[model samples]
Target chain A: MTDSEKGENQEMLDVFFEASRAQDPVPGSDLMARILADASQVQAGFNPAPAVVSHPSAGQPGQTLLSRIFAVMGGWAGASALTASVCIGVLYGATAPDTVRSYLPALDEQTAELDYSYLGLLDETVADLEG
Target chain B: MMPLDTNDDISDDALMVLFANGDGQAASVLAYRHTGRVLALALRMLGDKAEAEDVAQDALMRLWKIAPDWRQGEAKVSTWLYRVASNLCTDRLRKQGGKRASEDIDNVPEPKDDAPSIESDLIARDRANALQAALETLPVRQRKAVSLRFLQELANPEVAEIMEISVEAVESLLARGKRGLAEALEAQKMELGLDT
Candidate 1:
């Protein structure tokens, strides 16, 4: 097409588009309300920064360092790990003596005096019986 | 930390930053500012009011979610929104398998104020409907390029940004779309009493 023809065609399309532009729909209140509701729900938990339980400046001015550790580790993951560690320590304390006694038979009171004085005779008897 | 009543004075990027910083009203401002364009784009792309509304809501919801991580100076919020809405429209069009699945004028609900006020306005409305029908006959990409570039009056660069294509590609699409629209409009000109 010639430049004039192209220009005219473009002008024509412009007019058509301008006319149609007015008919474009505006979003209604209900849609806005729904969007705002989503925003509210999302913003409910949105903090500008992550939690800082262990910060040096956190808690009372005279608080001890140990208190800070407990405060910081009080969250779910930290609390769960602490609980598991305590349970394991208690379990080991409860079962360690019995496990050691079984492994070392002399530690058993019933078997503490089983010394055989005639070791040579016993070995000779065992050999002769096998023969 | 943005003060209330400051929304109107702040840029969209600023509003987004405020929203990310836990300002709830910032979200409301962004949504109100951008929903019209998003809805209009979806409506033109999908040709269904309800689907367009859904697409608009989904796009803005994505925007809301991305507020925290929104990098300043990366892109304009409006351009980002147009892109999201465009992608959604494409996904919907792809799911339906073709542009033929888009709703036609009879099925799509138009605003009551869209009714013609005069004979010329009536012709314009008819031509617009014809244009929309012709647009739906196009491949999804071409339709999107044409709608965004011509109807939405976005610059070639902005259209490229929204369509995620190079400027030359956008120009090519616009040329092809214009040809198709011209041909379609030519067929209906006499019937609609438009100037030749």
Candidate 2:
């Protein structure tokens, strides 16, 4: 089709399409009501589930006090464990001996010879001069 | 504050704010106002009334669940609901292996007429069925654009927001979709003697 013809045809088609769309029916009222009811039921079912609040009178007085104490003790124990872990880590980092040098005997001898030479008391130096 | 008397009088954003503040009535009003439109959109997209109803109900349920955390003015509530419902419908269609092709568009009974010729009524039914079939054959996005713009009477920007596409994309989809529909209906039009 030519451009003008295509445009004309498109316009006609648009008219028909719009008419058909206008003919489409709206959804029924009962459906909306049902959906609303279902949503309300869902909302009611939520409501934070009432948080399972424990009434003061619901538990025995002695059990409540014991539970409170246990909770506090559990928290303190967790904090103490964490602190102890940190302290141990710090002490190990600060005071641990350098075993890396002790692992190699050759490295220890090289260090001793270097120290004697620095003090001007090397036996090798005297022997070389006499030769 | 006194409760809003009319659902239409209150904007969706305002309703969402009230719902966020724990207003059950506001939630109900919002649900009642938009459920039908969302259900209809789902029905047209999914081509099954029951599934559409399920999607609508599920969408509203989700809205209520999220109402407490909903931020007002962030988005239109209806637009949000449409997106959710559309996504749900798309999921259902995918899971069902796209077995929705056998929609009852063919069985859309003609309007009753006492003084009509059988041939004319048959012609009209054929035309309507052809249009429905053509619409069904388009890609989902194109079909959605066509339906929302023409059928749901939503504007371009609103359709864009609901479809989560740019306005230009919506226009492109509608243009291409209409061309495809025109081509598909051309043969049916010839059969119905309306092509000329």
Most accurate candidate by TM-score: 1
Model 2 chain B poorest 10 in a row by lDDT: B106-115
Clashing pairs in 2: none
For model 2 chain A, where is the 10-residue window of minimal lDDT? A18-27
For candidate 2, give fnat to 2 decimals. 0.28
Q: Model 2, stretches more than 4 Å misplaced? A: A45-131, B1-7, B105-129, B190-196
* Model 2 C-alpha lDDT per residue in residues A1-131, reported as the tens digit of each score: 68886786676566556444433434457766776676667566655556677654455555767566545555578668878999988887787656645677898788777744544666768878999
Residue B41 displacement in candidate 2 (angstroms)? 2.0
lDDT of 1 by residue, B44-145 (tens): 888888888899999988888888888999999999999999999999989988736445555343544745577766766666777778788888899999
**Residue B9 error for model 1, in Å?**
2.7
- Model 1 accuracy (lDDT, Cα): 0.81
Best by lDDT: 1
